[model samples]
Target chain A: MTGTGGRARYLWLGGLVAICLGLLALAAWQLVVLERQMRIAATENMIWVFGQTQIEALNLALALSDEAALQQIQTRFDILVSRLTLLEDGPQRRFLENAGVSETLARWRSGLLALDPAQGADPAALRAHVTALVAALRTKASLVMSHEWQSQATRLDSLRHLHLLALMSVLGAAVAGLGLVAILIDRERRLMSGQLDHLRAEKLASDLERERETSENHRRFADLIAHQFRTPLAVIDSAMHRLTRRSGGPVPPELISEKAAVSREAVARLVKLTDTALMMSRLERDAVLPSLRAHDLNDLVSSVIDDLMATAWDRDPARIRQSVQTEPTVALCDPMLTAEILSNLLRNALLYSPPDCRVDVSVFQSRDCIVCRIEDRGRGMSPEEIECAFDRFYRGSGHETLPGSGLGLTLARDLARIQGGDVTLSQRDGGGLTAALYLPKDDVA
Target chain B: MSLRYHIVQTALMTALVFMAVPAAAEDVLLTLTGAVTDGRVEMTRADFDTMDWHEFSTSTSVTDGRPEFRGVLMRDALAHAGAEGSSVRATALNDYVVDIPVEDFHRFDVLAALYMDDVPLTPRDKGPVWIVYPRDNHGVLADIRYDMRWVWQLVALHVQ
Candidate 1:
């Protein structure tokens, strides 16, 4: 995979880790809150139970006659005893037993039983017994209430302690999570720095290698041109010298015309070779960075079409037709680079078109980008040709009849990439070729 | 074992009879007696103003109708009487009595209401006085500790 793609993958992984940690923190906080609420609910329930028990005991004591009151008190006492057992092992349970309030109640119950109404009871003795019973019931109720209060206090204290501990733990975990995030970010930064350094080193080495290769190719081309020129030049000069040395025979017009034509062809070949070498060198070097500015893509296409007008005029009138589908297609880009790409595509379309065919140039805005297409109605290229169409010095099979260096598309593609765009070639719908330039709109400075 | 011994026994018997005559008369005339010693009592204007004894009222029910007597609370009267006792025995004119512990009185507001509404009471109205509480103030008091603050022909507070 490419370096940028790998970096994006790493960033995605980091994002997932951050999301997971966030969810974990949220879950922990929820649990802590739930536990706190549960503790509060338990304390409130205990308070309610204490209040209910006291009220019930008071009501039972008041409703019955002395004989009956004792039995009711006994029954209530039994219920309270059972409830006390349910209080879990705590200070509340201990308080109930230690108060001896329940024993006092039992004694009062027996005292009430002894004072039978059938016997002429002495008022003093009866009053004393009732008073003792009331006192015993009040003491018992107070003991139960106090025990509940103490239990609630203890539970609240423990809950507060637990809350504090949980809060501290959450804070600690959050801090650790933050620390982990920072470390991960730092590691990622270091990795990116290392990768950048490696890329820079590799690029520098490749640049040096490319420079050496270009120099060698230039030298070899110059030598090949010189060697190609030498044979024709030698023939022309030797023939002229021979003719001059003889000084007796008149030179034949046909023979002189043939020699002149041969020399002309050799010079032309030399010029073509030089121009091809220059184009190759231009394509191999990186294009200059574009000074991006907003410009009308439609106007740029129109201007390129104007430049190609003279060349199109040389072809059959019907074949040289051009059309523009959109106007005022505004975009943010380097106008010069956009013009260059459009000019190259238009040139290719016009060059490869058959006689009496049409070349269409269009500029339009697409979603978040601008598209410029140049279509030609001509014999289309094969898939292989389209694939290699943007490569340096590549010429299609059908382009043998065309007199051109094959570096235009390569140069255009390089310029497009520098401007954050690309060039693509495809077969046209009918029977021709179409070239498209996709330029990204500059939304970020 | 002669005439002087008979005379001493007869004189002791007469002295006992004389002491018993006043006790019987007090029971028949007063209808209620004794102080509510120990603990406290609370009264509100809705019942009777025990603080002012002159104005009293009574509520009539079929089971208990008597004159209502306006007076200070039994506990307060006992306090005023400077009585010292561990309990208060509240008795109706019919001789029905309930012993209220001093501690219970301390913990609860046991009131001796002298009025029902804003009118004077008679015996047929079931009161010369009664004991009452503001039971409607809380749900926990909606039952019998409140009901024990009985109305009608209320009579005596005996300190024990």
Candidate 2:
């Protein structure tokens, strides 16, 4: 159910960031604890405490003559003993142990322990002990203070060293985390850039493919134009040359008209070929938008059939049969474009079929459109040819040698489509091709 | 009582017990003292051979290649001297001392080697007795600390 991977990736990144923050927090906490320990160590210097105890003991001995003084002396003695006890056995002994202070403290502790406060309550005895203790304390206190200062300095150095170590470790962790993050970002950037590059490459490839197709189409058009124009031009030139030679000889009037007619026919073919090619080029570019007008479908088809029959050179006119509806069928279309469409379809029907075969033309109104169907009892196109029948340069199978530029069907289709209509070629029933043309009906219809 | 008294008594007893002892037991290679029930124990190559001899092949930093070390286990050697301690301060011929925890002998098959390549070693060759751990067999022991602990020409062990 959880198919979106991008969300998971962001969650992992957030988790990693949280872990890095937690590590930093832990390091800061440790640093705070170490700082607290350093502060406490700095304030609790035992050497100074030991010196104060000695001063208090001396004061107690001076004040031991009265009851209040006696009680004060007892308290002072207890305090001095406690200080000595700290020097002897407390955690601070490690600093004083290496110094010769341990020996002096040990001797004083033993002597002081042997002297009971109640048994040695006499002020004279207490004074003697206090005086000796003071002398011993005086000699050792400064030595102990120097030792303690040295130890504190050493401890401070070690703490600074530890602080530096912690700082370096935290910095190292930060650098490592940042380096990993940088690597991930760089990798993501590269992946994104790679995807962009792939898309760009794909677009460039398609562009190259389209350019290649355009150039190929241009090359085919050039060959077709040259071949189509040269034949007609060559026919006209030969006919004129023949006429000029004959005129220089015996100028026969009947042969002259015939020769002139042949040249005129060739010239007409050249002009028609040029016009068709120019129209095809314009239609290919979608440069001509249709100018529609109301026209009778029956008249349009009948006129087209007459023009083909008049131009029929080898075929008999009786082979084309037309069936037009007696009722007026008006359609909205470009008249000249409709004529070009009908002419191309009729010509193809006449040329593809045998001269003896019948070409049928029918025009009728079908609902909102005017439909014209042309059927020929000729060799029908295969499924493949029928599929590509309207493609620019596709002359049907077995019709390559036929007098055609292969643009007739394409031009007919383009012309029909320009007037909000369409032309389709299909294999007619009983082995022949049929072309159906449809044009939009007039608004009055 | 005194070291001289005990030495004299031992000499008299040795002289009386075996006047024609073998020369193999004559050369003492390792000495043990401190926290030992025997007070002191001197081990000759013959005395080591009398104990269990374990043969193991291992390479050492001081050696060119893997060689078969024939020796008694450190635990057996310590037992021979009646050693009772948590750690042993091993001393080399060059006076280099290092504290080896008794746990090392218990943890690994360490050796007090008397011979290298079936030949008795002298002080110059880093032995009359050498403390060797199977460094090649146990990769964990192949470290500088363990290498330093492998004292060559091991002359004394003070258990404490």
TM-score each candidate. 0.36, 0.47
- lDDT, candidates in the order shown: 0.56, 0.75
Model 1 lDDT on a 0 to 1 scale: 0.56
Q: Per-residue lDDT of A1-445 in model 2, one digit per residue for the tens? A: 3456667666666766776676677678668867664544312456655665576557655655443554455545554554554454334455566666765565565465445363455666666777788888888878877877887788788778768767875885696588559858976998999999999999999999999988887888788878887877887788778777764668688777877777766677777788888998898788988899999888988888888766544458788888747877899998889999999998899889888999999888788889999999999898888999988888777777666788888899889988999999899999899999999999975
**What CAPRI class is candidate 1?**
incorrect
Q: How close is candidate 2 to the true structure, as a TM-score?
A: 0.47
Q: Which 10 residues in a row give candidate 1 chain A its minimum summed lDDT?
A: A80-89
* Residue A323 accuracy (lDDT) in model 1: 57
Error of 1 at A244 (Å): 2.2
For model 1, residues A201-263, the per-residue Cα lDDT tens digits are: 999999999899778766765655566556556756776665567566887787676666555
Q: Please, what's the RMSD in Å of model 2?
A: 21.3
